[model samples]
Target: MSAREPLIVQREVKPLDFLAAGETASEFKELLKSLGIPTDICRRASIVTYEAEMNTVIHGGGGVMSLRLEDDAIIIVAEDQGPGIADLEKAMQEGYSTAPDFVREMGFGAGMGLPNIKKYSDKLEIDTRVGEGTTLRAYIFIKGQREE
Candidate 1:
């Protein structure tokens, strides 16, 4: 006998969600908790999801965030249809942002999104095209959590 696995959960990130992106993170936190994911992994996943969701709202035009729980890891995929990152290397830098003044005024887009996402996730994959779109895949394993 084995414990039941959690079902896949997907949420659409509309431009409007930008006004309340924090809610997105909250939603994931609650869902992961309900699914019995380890606290550390859930925290990491929440951070990555929030960052990725913000990127979609601020840059990706619009996208979808999907989550799945595996026996050993949590998988998150954020896909958006918007202008892709021109320079992946440059974009990966912390505190580097291309957000306009309005977005900046909204207290988002401080350029820490990608860097933070990479920092917390065990594995990450980013796919983008200049004019096509972008897809980010992040994984957090459920073992060896560190104390805060």
Candidate 2:
């Protein structure tokens, strides 16, 4: 196998699916812990994953979250078929939410999802097409070196 080939694993997040929601991110966090990743890095990764998963569940309509484990970093990719973000800039702002009132009632749609993800990820990129879909790629360096 190529050295660059990732050790790939993934999980699906479905809307209103209580049984499996957020499980993927949780498992990813545990895997990172087992691999001896630093506490801070692991926590950041876990938080990012959860936020991304919530976005997928609440906004994406449903999607898949994948983890690509590389020697130097862990990559998170969240892809969904939900309506693409209409305003990327607005969505990035803290406390800006498009989630319905019911989701907010659950104390989850505080509008911190993208902001928190960006804060914790070493690198963040988003690809979205309104009425088509959205994809988010987040990188977390595991080498104890934070990117400036």
Candidate 3:
């Protein structure tokens, strides 16, 4: 991780890969811990990572998840080539979910992904197209930089 290059960790997420679901989040959290980031921020980043990872797996058909540690914040980016979210507003609602029956049966998609992501991250941005794909960027500002 060169200062000029920035510290970024990227991982590929496979569709329906329940077995590997939370791995990226766990690894990212560990990385944060190793860097001595605040516990709360680490937890928040992990939450964002897991939600993004799950969404990529269940709906994205596969994509890339990356963690970029910046001078003032930790950024989590999830990008997928799967069908994009048709209704962005509805998907932001806590109980709205497009996950299949099997996914719900497995105790995964209870909706809440975007809602929780919005809650945890200080800032969130999403760029999506109907057939192209979706890219979500969530930022957790370091201490002293975040607003109350």
Clash count for each candidate, listed in order shown: 0, 0, 0
Q: What lDDT tens digits, residue by residue, belong to model 2 across residues 1-148?
A: 1124375677878876544656777788888888888878878888888898889988998898887787788888888989999999999999999989988887878999999999999989899999998999888998867753
TM-scores of all candidate predictions against the true structure: 0.89, 0.89, 0.92
Clashing pairs in 3: none
- Where model 3 places Cα greater than 4 Å from the true spot, the runs are 1-7, 145-148
TM accuracy, model 3? 0.92
lDDT (Cα, tens digit) per residue for candidate 1, span 67-140: 87777878778888899999999999999999888999978889999999989898888988989999888878
Minimum summed lDDT over a 10-residue window in model 2 is located at: 1-10
Query: What is the Cα-based lDDT of residue 112 in candidate 3?
Result: 87
Give the distance in Å from residue 62's predicted Cα in candidate 2 to where it truly belongs.
0.8
- What C-alpha lDDT do the candidate models reach, one value each? 0.83, 0.84, 0.88
Q: Compare candidates 2 and 3 on TM-score and give the better one.
A: 3
Kindly indicate the candidate among 1 and 3 with the higher TM-score: 3
> What residue pairs are clashing in model 1?
none
